[model samples]
Target: MALWILCLLVVLGMGFNMVSGQGEDPFGPEGGRRREMVPAMFIFGDSLIDNGNNNDLPSFAKANYFPYGIDFNGGPTGRFSNGYTMVDEIAELLGLPLIPAYSEASGDQVLHGVNYASAAAGILDITGRNFVGRIPFDQQIRNFQNTLDQITDNLGAVDAAQALARCIFFVGMGSNDYLNNYLMPNYPTRNQYNGQQYADLLVQQYTQQLKTLYNLGARKFVLAGLGRMGCIPSILAQSTAGSCSEEVNQLVLPFNANVKAMLNSLNVNLPGARFIYIEIAHLFEDLIANSKIYGFSVVNRACCGIGRNRGQITCLPFQTPCENRDQYVFWDAFHPTEKVNIIMARKAFNGDTSIVYPMNIEQLANIDIEPN
Candidate 1:
């Protein structure tokens, strides 16, 4: 028997917000529901999926800083994108409300789960732009551990254990490590290591970090590999005469492939640990190859700034934004629009064992499993 459940969360952004049960939104009853699902979700990763762990961190991508959350909760929460991320969508699809920011760590946020992801974080200790002062994935793990301890202090250990097992732990970062270490030549970390060596260190760090989360009582996880970072407008600007850069793709493909291999190896060695890969290769490539199919009209250009270093230097208070943000694939050079994240989340949530690996988030949540 298939046990599935679905949840809905309706966030109202400016013009892009879609009514529930219809239109472009992923969680609002448009996609079929799941039954007996995980009660909550937690996320850890970069800008592509952060839900404002950068709230207290000092950085430019800080979503909790200002008009950022003008739409959602009336204050910025450091989410980076326009609105919503894979974590938000999945939480909605699981029949739960949006998991509160980890800093909002009340038993209230713990009702479903809490988001521990910081925008500049990576799988290793050395990722993210220097000007941006990254919160390394290991340090983020420390925050998660503290969050657990706080929960234990309040909810006790058994509840915390159940929370760890029944909730979907989403990991969607690590791109910045490569980006800062290899792509952007100006960083000190890049000058310190060759591409081959840095990539090797990155994978090793990712392996150990995932292990750390497991040791902390996280049982189910969704690991999203790097997508086509080469195709982003920022990279394209730096390419041969403003064209799509194949060199960036070179870095992405091998890194993502290795991530898959690492996950497989982890499954073989770690008992009771379940995981799924988000297939970022196909997802981003599909968006690039067929933009309209993904409902994006301007796939190559950013909806935010004037291009080039728009991924970083833009998002100013004076720059003009596009009229129809829903049609665009990107909000900034590096981050996807809310619409794009919704689709990605839908793809992730709807994935079965065949696509995601061992068990879907639903099953991993222990919503329905064969008796032991």
Candidate 2:
């Protein structure tokens, strides 16, 4: 009995380490700086980067179960990443816990932040319907407004406004609008309109959507632009005998460039409504150009299941899993590794945003506080 107890304890100890990040935060904001007040972070987007809203729905793209969270959290917490996501990292920077998924019943526990993002969702509803019945961006807004009302109804309008005014909203979607929605289906008018025209329509709708959110009290926005989809294992597999499709790259460039322009236009329109774009293209490119520099040994393969898209072919209850997940750069064909999301999130806030705009999430969150 004594020997059995000792062995049980040993296994439990290792399990605990795998969960709660071995009781240590990989990116705990302790590099000689930290925020004073906690800021709310609201997120909206798709599966290439969902933090768990899809778990609420009956979809295959969902990532709210076991084995998915084996790396960092030890158990599944609905996050799409192996553990934490970009939104989680951003919330940590603000001294807040991970943002709750909208599908969760405990949004009130972390009322300051909530994620309406669903895996496979997109800017347009058509894109979401392409893969699964995802919560469209517009519906995500409805959920956000409802969440605000929940706080206001209980805490009163003044308190709710005060809570939201200091909030930070991060939007990281649009890939599906091109991938599953416009380009893939039977030739539609949008597809024939050329990349520039298609991007314009997307920007117009996106701009209108953000304006609507601002009207509802969104002050700060961190928009994550199109990630490196051309470099995805799935897209690469579609090429001639395992090569990256340059055609995919050709399609992605115009959309990304247009997003930058539209973001600039939105910032110009909204006063005191600061906007920052998280450039994911170059980030992924770095992973390919120099893998060691970005901490990814395998730049194009996924770590789960089997086949080109990493079990996406037969991704179900009985698929086989890869032995070493840490060796791969992707968790699935479309999404990134948990470690990579951390790097991208850190760079988004601390690196170029500071240089590109002379301000960042760190500075904005700490604007009202005096240095200690």
Candidate 3:
């Protein structure tokens, strides 16, 4: 029965792509001459925005096959969502083609941008160690350095540097560091540090990481703060009444506060750095609290997976997803459906100061880069 559903999903995706003229450029005329909001986009994070960088890795943290991309035009291109991820929508809004996965990208594909997000990855190397074969945040930065070298080889060093300055560097990470590492019993992180202390350690490391990016010519950045981790399907499932774990939610508040402070400090110290913090916690809470307003009937249940809330287990190889995919906020045990992803991306692109503090992506994109 599960296999049958999987087959149907693939057929549906293929048919949709065929009818929608997916191959043809949806942005504009030929020669990649579309008017873009930014020169390019460099993505760094986890599965929430991973395109297909994990497909070739010897890792269990993969979504390269089956119902993963059941609603996407390309079909199971390793995005955890049933369709496009937030980054995909953000790219479209920026008038650029979807950023290619760094592992599979080359030639002109790298010109637009590259995604370094890996499923199960985190800010710390040991955060997702249980998954194995994952690229930690540090490695993702190194990969970006390699991409910079490649860009320099193609365009001259001066032009490549200018392009880098004009591009957007988006980072949506840290969730797995808390969820997969600190919370897991097998890990010694919890034994070493309490909630506040752990958050401090993570932020301390994160500060250096963003600084590294700044030194590497990343000027425009969008750092997405951790959302309401307790409200996620996986966390809710841990409760007998399916209520959110306040303890888990409280753990993330400090991290978010620290991240905001870090961004403010970076902006002051880095001179040219323009870092925008996306208040994901508030945005996610609004969606969950006012599901009906967002046209979602099921805010807690996942569209895929098994057991209560369809979250006790993740979406398996042949699992059937929900029929009304748009009604559910989550696509799997850990990720949001494409519908919600689009909503989040739209808000991050042009939302008010409450959601995107200081300025939104559209405002940041339009800011002219003044050379040092």
Best by lDDT: 3
Kindly indicate the candidate among 1 and 2 with the higher TM-score: 2
Q: In model 2, where do residues sit more than 4 Å from their true spots?
A: 1-37, 153-159, 186-192, 309-315, 318-320, 353-358, 368-372
Per-model TM against the reference: 0.81, 0.82, 0.90
- How many Å off is the CA of 122 in candidate 1? 2.0
Local distance difference test, candidate 3:
0.83
- As a TM-score, model 3 comes out at 0.90
lDDT tens digits by residue: candidate 1, 85-172: 7777777777766777666555323445566677767766656656475566787778767655653565445545554555577888
Superposition-based RMSD of candidate 3 using all C-alpha atoms, in angstroms: 9.0
RMSD of each: 7.9, 10.2, 9.0
Q: For residues 252-340, what per-residue lDDT tens digits would candidate 3 score against the true structure?
A: 89999999998889888887889999999888988988899889999887888888777799999868888999999999988999998
- Residue 306, candidate 3: Cα error in Å is 1.2
lDDT of each: 0.65, 0.65, 0.83
